[model samples]
Target: MAELQEFIDDRPDAREVRKALAVKLVYQGYKYEEIQTILDVSLGSITSWKQAYEEDGISGLRLNHKGKKSYLTAQQREEVLSWLQTKECWELGELEYKLAFEYDVTYESKRSYYDLFDAAGISWKKTTSLNPKADEDAVAAKKKEIETLLARHRQEIEEGKLRVLLLDECHLMWGDLSGYVWGKTDQEIAVRVVNIRDKQTYYGAVDYLEGSLLLKAYNAGNSENTIDYLRYLLDQSPQSKITSFFGDGASYHRSHLVQNFLGEVNQDLSQEEWKIHCVRFAPNCPSQNPIEDIWLQAKTWVRRFCALIPSFSHLKWMFEWFIRHTTFDFATLQMYGAFSEIKY
Candidate 1:
């Protein structure tokens, strides 16, 4: 409207002018059609301009509101956003501790003091694909199919009154980078790292639980290592009379070496003759295997206390430690409460 233009023109740097116009147009009794006729602007423009003035005050009265912050001070917004991006967080109340430790001053702060940090509009996130590399629905269906087959086997054995060992393998890569919460994001990202010292070295494990175990890593996953891992498990739990083994459709699990090893192990114990029945999971359905959850559980522990791990060996050691302690705690044994058990 001519009135709005006149107001902006007359009031040089008059921030309050925008609030006055908004109150009159929207809050006070004024017909938008009549107001538009008087101002010579469209309803959309009026809406846009009114919102603009409310946000920027007098500066918002401008035709556009760009490169300006709302509620958040520039430095405060930057600091808070940057902190959120890292693995560190400073409490609003204890911010005085940081002040005292660094600047030797204890400044008081209110809980709402962080409101400006939130109003900076930094928390919005863009949607990302659950499986950026593959179809999620297909993957889920495959996992379900594998689970169903295993469930059928378990049901049959249970009805017939039998105890069977579910033998399998897991590999530990020395340079496994695992996943991380890095890069420019409001969401977490998973990045793989190569093991420089060793590539194909693996670990095999066989477990007989109601569910399945899965070995996860980058492309460095293979079968020879899986069998070797199984051998180790056999050595430790020699008394375990497992009857069968199940694995996902990875090339390693189906390889000649793995089959030969299992055959040899079976032949050695001919008297017991535990059935070497094997079932392969639907291809690429790692989620169906409970072992994947095991790895995720391990990684979550690393994120809780430590930020950057120095090397792959450290990662392995810490992971083993976390797993041992986590398994011991009753709180952790309960589904989804595993991480809460870490007293340290």
Candidate 2:
């Protein structure tokens, strides 16, 4: 029944689509009032549609047309399809205004407006903001460079001379927990979150060669936190001939303090055989970092039991549990497409 409602909500075939949807709801034990409210049809219409469906199956419903024909003609529909093909962003209210003023057509409701968009094979969805600074060609070149460097590092790892680690920071707040879960289609499933600005920022690093994760929670990310993390890593693996760590182009990663900590010559910028090396990932490119995958898995696990997580301390405990219990595979992480996509 939920699936049927989704189908009905998504397309604008005809008025009969609503009747068909009503019939399904009726069969699913929905009261006429509920059906009328959901489908935006009168009780009389709902009764007639149900009777028509019961008397003659789908054929009876098809015979009943509730109103005049759609305002969008065949040519206009073709125009809409072409516009959709252009992949331009549109607001529903803007489209509604365009329909009313430009085409002299008005939909009965927002539902009907969306139905027309669905008919045009368009959908409303959540979107991520794209970085305007990102360049495809530069990203491709950087990806190739990273892959070549990784291949060389892999050879060093085999010789027990180098260890490669990917690092990133995650803001762990009460609102961070959200994902699809089993719930009634007509209602929303709410996750509890605190109103206070209380959160923890975790600086996390994963050794792709050993599949071991190092994590530290902080109030915020800065040069101090980044340098502190690098110092911790240096102490953890002091004997390694070379420890190369990859991170995003955050200011802290390139700060003078961090550079000095890594033993780099800040003035001349010459390469030195330091025990630890800091490598910055390409700007606006996160797919290259596998630590993101680890955080995703951990956050997913935390969201699964969102009801049980009541406090910040409990959230930290859950993070600890996930990290200790989960056995992240090294070979799988190394072969992740973020690395393979660059290989020619």
For candidate 1, lDDT tens digit of each residue in 1-344? 45555675576544345434643566456775666555443344445456666666655555344522223446654665565555333444343333333333321122233443354333324454233445567666655654454455554344332223333334555444454454665566543344545433223222333222322233345675566555554555454444443545567777898888778777766633543445554554454345454565665676543446666666666766655554322221222111111112
Task: Give the clashing residue pairs of candidate 2, or none.
Answer: none
Any runs in candidate 1 off by more than 4 Å, and if so which?
1-220, 243-245, 268-272, 275-277, 328-344
What TM-score would each prediction reach against the true structure? 0.43, 0.64
User: Across residues 94-113, which tens digit of lDDT does each residue of candidate 2 receive?
Assistant: 66555655665555445766
Q: Give candidate 2's error at residue 15 in angstroms.
A: 11
- Provide backbone clash counts, one per model: 12, 0
| Candidate 2 ranges with C-alpha deviation above 4 Å | 1-67, 71-79, 93-121, 135-138, 178-192, 210-212, 264-273, 327-344
Cα displacement (angstroms), candidate 1, residue 69, comes to 20
